[model samples]
Target: MTRSAPQFLCDPVLETVQVEHGFGTRGAVAPGGTLRPNQVHGNAVARFEGGSGVDPLEADALLSRIPTQSVAVVTADCVPVLVASADGGCVAAVHAGWRGLACGVIPAAIAALSEWGFTDLRAAIGPHARACCYEVDTPVLEALEGPFGPALAEAVRPTRPGHAGLDLQRLALEALSRGGIRSDHRGSAAAMCTVCHPELFDSFRRQGDQAGRMIHWVRPIRDA
Candidate 1:
């Protein structure tokens, strides 16, 4: 197996604490075997205790209090969300495609963390296909609109006759807000569109199945 340097984008808020969180680029590799769930575009979240190796849980989100265990989600066009407790006791990674978002993945993750006794969480939204390049049809808009309402519908601006550009980051932020994460508690979106910045990130919508996946992970730094 070929390993690459740990070239990743870090959120300033997450970096301030003992939490080690990042959004990896195409070739960057994580230190240990990253715990990635088999994302099925649904709103399932898997929780982990201190352990090693991969379990390949069938879910869209992974939550853990184990500092030594890193949880991650791989994405090409979907949004990758990494969240940590205010004190770095717990962390979570979510894979939110439009369908997963529609099914309540963000809120589900928040609830899982809350159940783990975490509060005042901080989150980072990683790179993905932004509204600038994520054009979608009526069903996608409808899936979001019924649950998220008008604000979400407004984010989906009409690009062509029947297609519209959907801002996944905006929708994710809304979901976070609805989950009780204040504006200050969340980091800004990476703001780089994977579809637009092919040299930096990958985009399934742009490159189809040939597009490589990027890993976005977060873990608490274990005490020595």
Candidate 2:
């Protein structure tokens, strides 16, 4: 893939609401006042009210009710999920890996955000290691089966012994579906495979711990 300016991908649903958001690429900078969690690959969420809370929250997701106070999550190969209400009064950023997914990060975050109200929720899954390059073993498969059930087979194709190519994006969409977001309402503006495009993304699967992470963020629109 050709390199572009440090930028972010926008979801049409979020655009309609005019929320300042982005699924970032390498070297990309998000909007101001963005707060990110430490991301332990668990389902926990750190929520902020009108004021900025402590930095480096020990959670996999960040939720913001303050209009200008944005929330973000960083990832190398793991999925970056950005969610918000239609008017952008509430927003969340999630770091979803196979572990987080199996542990229910998506639904957990949505359930947390729902406390504000579940009306017109929208979500977008960002770039990560795609199925074309993301392969998993039996234990990983078994862990995912709880959340994916019979549908898990659809996103998997046998690879090496005890391994299969897994579509992280498909599973992510399924998780969002469980959270009440329709297929059309869920966004994939930057669902490209991070492993496939080293020119544009930083992939841990491809570059290991040395690989850098990309930032994804969302901010509620301040009421006029």
- Which candidate ranks first by TM-score, i.e. highest? 2
- Candidate 1 at residue 165, lDDT? 89
lDDT (C-alpha, whole model) for all candidates: 0.85, 0.87
Model 2: pairs clashing at backbone N, Cα or C within 3 Å: none
Error of 2 at 75 (Å): 0.6
Among all candidates shown, the one with the greatest lDDT: 2
Model 2 over residues 1-224: C-alpha lDDT tens digits?
Answer: 99557878888878877888888889999776678988888998788886548334799988887886888999998998988887778888999999999999998889888876755788998999999999999999999998889889999999889899999888889999988898888989778899999988999999988899899999988992
TM-score of each: 0.93, 0.94
lDDT at position 23, candidate 2 = 88
lDDT of 1: 0.85
For model 1, the superposed segments whose C-alpha errors exceed 4 Å read: 1-6, 51-56
